[model samples]
Target: MMDSNDTPVDVRLSLRVNGQMRQLDVPPNVVLLDALRDRLGLTGTKKGCDHGQCGACTVLVNGEAINSCLALAVVHDGDDITTVEGLAGEADLSPLQAAFLEHDAYQCGYCTPGQLMSATELLSNRKVGTTDAEVAEAMSGNICRCGAYKNILSAIQETRQQHAGAAID
Candidate 1:
């Protein structure tokens, strides 16, 4: 029975979320996703299998996506965090978002946020290319219950093509 105003000491969380600095007070047992959604109110990171079996709790820690549910909010102090909600900016969708829309990459969208986070990490890496096998390997961790794997890869490939074309021009 935790009551309000009980030990009102502010816990410090020095982290970069979506390129912004954030310092928050959270309980010791609070998982990263819980703190992000419940405290920071960033809900793009979903919770599918709170045990990390599913990749629905993905978010980037310093550009590398992680399963936030498996991490305590306290452990991530002074780290960078990027949720699916942080992917876009200035009223514009990310290239990945645009490609997902163009290729109908998702169905129901429960797993979409995780897929997006994984895809964002993959695309951010300069080594990943437009190969189907490559995309499959990269996204193997994310499970789309809707089974939209083919469409997901297609959208990723399309985004790579667009990026390549832009780079060439």
Candidate 2:
């Protein structure tokens, strides 16, 4: 859309990001990943494989994990979004974050944010199986170029065990 002066108009969006209400005026075509990183300064969500093949841009939208690179910012107005930055509390890291650290789940750390976000959703989902194979299959979308899949899987399993009966928010 253009104004009378032929200048592109940015769409206003209100989103509850990481428990904070954030407002941004971005181009209608701006993907959620760009909006979060470039506009809101939340660079934890990486821009790898912008085509959405790699899950490096994964983020929680309305409590579900999605590839932010595939979602338009304007369409998610009022949606609750969670990036890797929001995984921790005021003074402590979240269980999954701690698990990742304890298990050394990352090598280069480029894909760690996406891994954690995907694991977060997986843990909360009771439909996914508890076996390592199931977990691995569920997380196949997020590729670890450094070949840290074993450690990543360990961290996810450990965290899943810890929150066995509890519902992860």
Largest TM-score belongs to which candidate?
2
Q: How close is every model to the real structure, measured as TM-score?
A: 0.87, 0.94
For candidate 1, write residues 72-116 as lDDT tens digits. 998999999999889887899999998899889999999899999
Candidate-wise lDDT, in order? 0.86, 0.94
Clashes of 2: 0
Superposed by TM-score, candidate 1 places the C-alpha of residue 85 at a distance from the truth, in angstroms, of: 1.2
> Which runs in model 1 stand beyond 4 Å of their true positions?
1-10, 127-130, 164-169
